[model samples]
Target chain A: MEQQIVKVKNKRGVRVIPGFGLSMGITLAMLGTLVLIPLASIFISASQLSWEAFLDVVTSRQVVSGYVVSLSCAFFAALVNAVFGLMLAWVLVRYEFPGKRLMDGIIELPFALPTAVAGISLTYLYSDRGWIGALFAQAGIQIAYTRAGITIAMVFVGIPFVVRAVQPVLEKLDRQYEEAAEMLGAGRICTFFRVILPELFPALLAGFGLAFARGIGEYGSVVFIAGNIPNKTQIAPLLIMTKLEQYKYADATAIALVLLVISFLLMLFINSVQLYMQRFGRG
Target chain B: MAQKRQRTYQQDIVGDGILAVQKVREPHTEASGKGIRCGLIGICALFLFVMLVLPLAVVVINALRDGWAAYQEAVMDEYTVRALQLTLFTAVTAVAVNTVFGVFAAFLLSKFYFRGRQILAALIDIPFSISPVIAGLVFILTFGNVGWMGDFLKAHGIRIVFAVPGVVLATVFVTFPFVFRELFPVLNAQGKDEEEAAALMGAGWFTIFRKITFPHMKWALLYGVILCAARALGEFGAVSVISGHLRGKTNTLPLHVEILYNEFNTTAAFAVSSILVILAVLILIARTIVEWKKA
Candidate 1:
């Protein structure tokens, strides 16, 4: 038994502290109860419906519009977040100024604040009679209660993901590459594009994926700002919520299964891209 | 020196064109560098102000729009107080269970190698991407009257959906990954040295953990718990589905805000929001302190 223990240790590296069984038991039990089985319930329940029923729920006009609004707004917001968040990460990592610490701390407010609070604040700020909305109204622009408003809410919540994701990568990056390129007579912009951006692209992509995924599932943050008009600004998550409220449990799960499948695929795609980029960078 | 020669060569190259006269006249590019830096910083500052600071200011401003008497009235009202209690109850329940399970999962993944570990990690992150509305549906499908286990739970006289227990379960499902994600990297980075050392000294597993790993993980555990609490407290989407919107009963703070807002009671909605805003600010302050201390 002692010899077997030693061999096991050799194979998997040393881990002398005992009770792996105990920890694993606790972990698997809780995870199965809380996450695995519950998620599996969606598939199980969804399967109870016939093919026609499933198709009917998923292909409904309202559901289709919800998918479009959610994806487009999330896509646009993530794109916006990618640009501004990259810049924000760059400034946070590369510069030192007064209140920089305060600014760094402020980026995470959206993560901590209630989505309802964020929603109301955005709506209040951009409503027709509100502060920023009044300015836009004069310029013949409508923001609140439209796709623009939904996208803005998404951008607010999504900013932290990109900023947080890219900030560490930026910090750990070696400045010598850019300096080398510069010494070879490349201008700042050229060196940035040729040397720095290639290294930052993977982190940027991962950030965009995260922001986009979160925006897809986002409800409370978008619902208030969206004006919640069906086939207009409504999102898939809100549609599910509305379905469940009306006790259309089958329809709710049907829509959920679709969203769940898409989100999983997106995550898998992002993970693969990140893995590929890591290998690409190493070479 | 090579540096001096290179500088003059650059000057010569610049002197070969219109840029040359400006470089020689300025004699130092420090001012231009400073100017560029200032411009970038200015833009970042303005962007953060417009995006983050202004929205935050709006919450507080509108929450207190009607002055102290009305603000106090809204806060002291029965529904608001009930919502606060329910929110706290659900969040505390979630944090407690998630912390224990999170630590266990973290320890298992980091301390031992096993098959399906990657699968387990990915499963934990399911919550991170799953929409909260969907999060609620899965639970309802498991526990609601028309649910798969509905007959079983009813036979056992246990109510989950549309009750406080349902709210707790949904919160747990949504915030499940927060503590685990926070602790997993920290524990992995810590390695198993201290635990192994204690084991060699004839210490038991629990003793080794209590003496060594817990001390090392204390701050991270606290940070995780804080984040979990903030998320649970602020959760609107998941809680709304299971809450059933019973006034002074199932409604949490966020749901209460929605109820009031839908009723067109903007003043009360904003009033209740200020309290949640304070909670958010407190969480942010705690988070900042932790990060600052880490530095």
Candidate 2:
């Protein structure tokens, strides 16, 4: 029926697909309405503040500590996840054992599980009376409701990013370089350091960057576990939430703008690096 | 365009590289490290258990802490049911809107050529790198009281912030990229030759899409929707920011869990969480099956 309408408008030599205009128009409209506009609103609203005010909001004592806690926790999480997630990926890609499928599936638990769920569960698990917490309690080491708890939650969610990033790279890695390294009088450890590590370096960097960005933004999981004691375990994202809760719109946006810019740069850098590696890794 | 084609060529070469590696592979001293392999595998197991399994087991355990009666009481309560309804209602809505949008966007991106295409692609990807917390903040800034639309919306007496609409919008924003990302790569891989042929034969867009494009894109679309559903159901940060913590009103399951946990209603909190945890596990199963089938 629609084709019947388009048939009359069609030229003899040219074939027009129905709905191209409608589809493209709808796509662009939604893209603009849902994505571009709201994102742009951040900068536009943020611009409402004076430059000094913007600096003050982002550099306040509380905000500074938040930045410290968030950045340090995320940095630690990403650093740990990059090493351990690579190992997990290596195990999945380069080895076979019983329950391998189960292990592989479990690696994605963080991806599928709700952060709120992760938060509460991690809290319960590490709370003094909780199972894991009880163990740590015996050692006089507190895990839950601390910075360590926050880091643990960040690590939980960030690990999958690293594993997912590195798995395919490991699977497709050409073995020739390692063989050639061995032929050149290099030991296994030496060969890995010189040859295989370089190839995997880009993946590791991309994963770490992505994980760090995620950890910095992470709130749901971190909030439940973090004591949320102001300037202690409070993270930047949580600080923004607190500011928003107080109806400090400008301050919230100022902080969010900083985070937004940082995340955007990190994401952009990772994308370009990953794209380059995909194009040239094997070469 | 040339870059995308080059990436595909590289992918093919990498596939060939894998085969080449297999052909020339031989046992070496490094390959003979059975004990080390076991040790590595053991560490992986411990990591998985300590991280993934322990938390999951804890959720189940705490949910049933008071036995089946308490679990039932927690889950079947009016507020709990209401939270579930709100979560499902908005998640389904977000998924439907984004799925339609994702299809249209991916189709436009894969078929048509125009300026600013790269920008359009990058815009679709913006949500991924964005913090969920930031995502929530942006929406509130746009639609909250004293926001750009605040006056207009207030004049209309429509409440978005601290309401269901805000919750849905935030969920939509955060989960928007999943379907698009999933479908774009698949749709791009499937160029437009068949679509062009179908158009030439005088098929309507609906007919062409249903007959030709849908078959090729169905699995990818399904994959995208599943992922979108998983994310929509699990979204917390964005929804929490706008949801206002109104029990049985604005609260989704995640928010409900937060409320209960904070209230020291551990049983109820864990029970409500188990509902989502179950849903999440189901999503994981569906994803695994989808991946297995796709592979």
Candidate 3:
């Protein structure tokens, strides 16, 4: 019995802490029931549709337009976030100012606040009678119930991803690089563009990808602001809801399957990039 | 010696000239640097104000736009009250279940080297990337009338889709990764040497965890719980899909806000939203405290 136990240990390597079976059992059981099985149902339901029918559902004009609005709005929003998020992170990390901690704390507000609240509040704020919206109304640019409104909603939800992603990397950044660049006659703009930005690129890209992916998948915040105009401001997730509401289960599954596949690929890419970055150190 | 002395004298004068030039430029550069700093800070402040702070303020202002009496009436409405109760129940249940699963998964992944560990970690993160609407959709497809187990569930007299169980299930799915993600890094950093040492001394796994691992994980676990609970409390899209708009029966706070807003009961919607905003603030405060403690 002792020899058999030793052999088992030798083969699998030593695991001194007990409860492997118990922990693995509970983890897999919960993960399977709660996450995997339900996710698989999407695939199973989608598979029930023939390839041609699946293509037809996903490629239909309204659905195609939904994809366009979602992807474009998310793209622009993430782009905005990448720029502003870097600025916020830079301000938080490099400068000492009043209310810095408060600023830091509220960077997570979007994450903590309910999307429904954000949706209603944003819609109100940017509506024509509201303060900011009234200003834009005079400028002859409508925001609420438009593509711009949808983009703003996306930006709000995606803000935390980039800020949180880049903050740590920025904080850990070596100051010596800045000093060296300055000593080498690099001006402030040149130093930032050439020296600091390169180092922050990987983290910035990771944040951008996360924010973009999130913006694409965002629903509650955008739906109210999006105005749900078919073939115009309608987002992909909202279309799924529309299909579900109409009891078109197969159609909903097909759209969801497309989204799932895209998001999965994006996540896989981000994870691999992160893994590579960790191995190679900061770029 | 005289030639070297002459060269030293020239070098000293040249150095003095350079110093004088830099001294002349110092004030100007310093002023610009300060200006740049203030500009950057101002932009960040303005953006965050517009994006985050302003929307929060709007909720409060609009909620009170109808006067205190009206705000109170909306909040005290029977359906709103029921929705609040249901929201609390779902948040608590989801947090409790995820907390247990988080601990087990964290321990298993951090302590033991096993096959398919990477795949498991990735699988855990799937919920985070997937849309909440899809999360709800998957559940409906699994438990709705035409689902795979639909007939079996009907035979058993079980109703999950468009019911409270479906609501809870969707909440659980979306918040699944939060606790595990939070706990894993802390556990992995602490490593297994201490746990292994305790084990070799004839301590049981539970005892070792209580005396050793649990101490290190307490703050992270709390942080995770706060995040999970906050998310579970505010979840809208998933609950919205699964709840079937059965006001007073299935509406969570977020869904209640939606129903109110859509019905043009704008004041009522903002009032209920104020509750969630306050809860979010409280969670933010709790998260700040946990971060400080963890650090």
Candidate 4:
């Protein structure tokens, strides 16, 4: 019916697919109901408070610490995933070894594994009496119930994003430029630094941004491991839950507002970056 | 383009060089010669094993320590059994509902044309960026006491914030995107040519969908459904907030594990966690296979 009604366009057309008008309308409605309305309500509820009260709630010592821990851990974890996840992607794309399939499979373990279960497992494995924790404990290196534990959990959850994002780029990459560099007598390291890294830069940033976003809101995994030591190891998500549990509704909303705002801005920036990359990426 | 070309070139050289090295490296000192590739593979496996496998193995070992007796005891307990049943029931319902709604949304996004398309596309990712816990909070603020719709619903006694209904709602929120994300790309790549051809041959929408479209979407749909199921079963933060964690009422398996762990019943926690681990492993295996086939 569509083909019969609509004339065929030239190959170099404005759109990739037809029916853009209808699809976009339906997409708008779905997004409105599922996302926009609820998010709008969060901000509205947040606006109910006076500016001073909002400031007080967001600036409390515990709240400030929570923000610090959550943000710093998210940043560092994403950085770590960016660095190592690229390596993992490179290995998968460049090498053929036994258990290659297994490595690929395990890369996504964090996605299917329940955050709570992962947290419990991490706590069990890294607690003072647990296996690795015993070694860390003896060396005066804390893991579980500490900032380090939070970072570990964040990294675990965030690694998959980087790997998934970078893998396809590595696979689709053409081989001419690096060969030319090598043919020009460039060292292996120099060839990599000069010829390859720039192309991956956009993808790397996008992946890092995604990982950072994911790490911020992480709860189930971080909660158990962080020990929720208020003002110390407590992340913002936990702080929000704690506030709610304690019947501090106003404070809870305020803290949640802070997280929501930060996450919203962060995501907006990332989305723009991704859009920029997607545009430049094709060239 | 330069980067892509360079990356591939480097990779080919390195990969081929390593293979060549493996063949030519003498027997003596061969281990050191194969160090880079071998060490890289070994390190990746070790990281996966320590992080992904060990805790899961510990749970399984602990659960089976007393053999079938312990497994049976845990599974047969009234609270444990009830929680398990409710979790399964809710997960199934959530995934099914999300699948229908998700396919519609994906179909619309993939097939239609309209205004606000870019904005709408961005909104699908809201659930992804927002915490599940925060999603629950959003629902509560919209439907709970003092919520925007609370007064009208409370008058009708149609509670939605503190029962199984709320759990299902939260689960739906988290899992809604799974099917849509999976199906959108498939739909984009396949296009509507064949469906239009079927329509030209006098097929109805349902016929075209059932015979022409679903076949293409089947594997992706299955993949999405499985991922959604895994998430629904293991959902803790969102469901816990809205469900009130009412032991037999809202306590999911993950919550049950937490309760047991807090009670210091490590065995029970491990036992329940082991079940989830098995489910996760199955999902992981299925996802891996599907992805490999796609690749």
* Candidate 4 chain B, run of 10 with poorest lDDT: B21-30
Q: Which residue window of length 10 is worst by lDDT in model 3 chain A?
A: A181-190
Model 1 misplacement above 4 A: A1-9, B1-32
Q: Poorest 10 consecutive residues of model 3 chain B by lDDT?
A: B20-29
In model 3, pairs of residues that clash are none
lDDT of each residue in A235-270, candidate 4, tens digit only: 998888887777666787888887877888998898
What is the Å distance of residue B180 in model 3 from its true position? 0.9
lDDT, residue B185, model 2: 80
* lDDT of prediction 1: 0.88
Sort all candidates by TM-score, best to worst.
1, 3, 2, 4
Candidate 4 lDDT, tens digit per residue, B1-295?
Answer: 8888778767766664556544333322445436766776677777677777777776777777777888878867788888888888988988887787667777766655556656666677678887777878877777878577889999998988888888888887877687788888898788877866776677766776778778888888888888888888888888877888789887888889888888988877878887788889998988878776665
Residue pairs in candidate 1 whose N, alpha carbon or C atoms collide under 3 angstroms: none
How many clashes would you count in candidate 4?
A: 10
Candidate 4 — which pairs collide? Answer: A19-B112, A19-B113, A20-B113, A20-B114, A21-B113, A21-B114, A22-B113, A23-B112, A23-B113, A175-B9
Clashes of each: 0, 0, 0, 10
Each prediction's TM-score versus the true structure = 0.93, 0.89, 0.93, 0.88
How would you encode candidate 1's per-residue C-alpha lDDT over A97-120 as one tens digit per residue?
A: 889888998898898889998888
The residue ranges of model 3 lying beyond 4 angstroms of the native Cα positions read A1-13, A276-283, B1-29
> What order do candidates take by lDDT, descending?
3, 1, 2, 4
- The per-model DockQ list reads 0.55, 0.44, 0.50, 0.41
TM-score of chain A of each: 0.95, 0.87, 0.92, 0.89
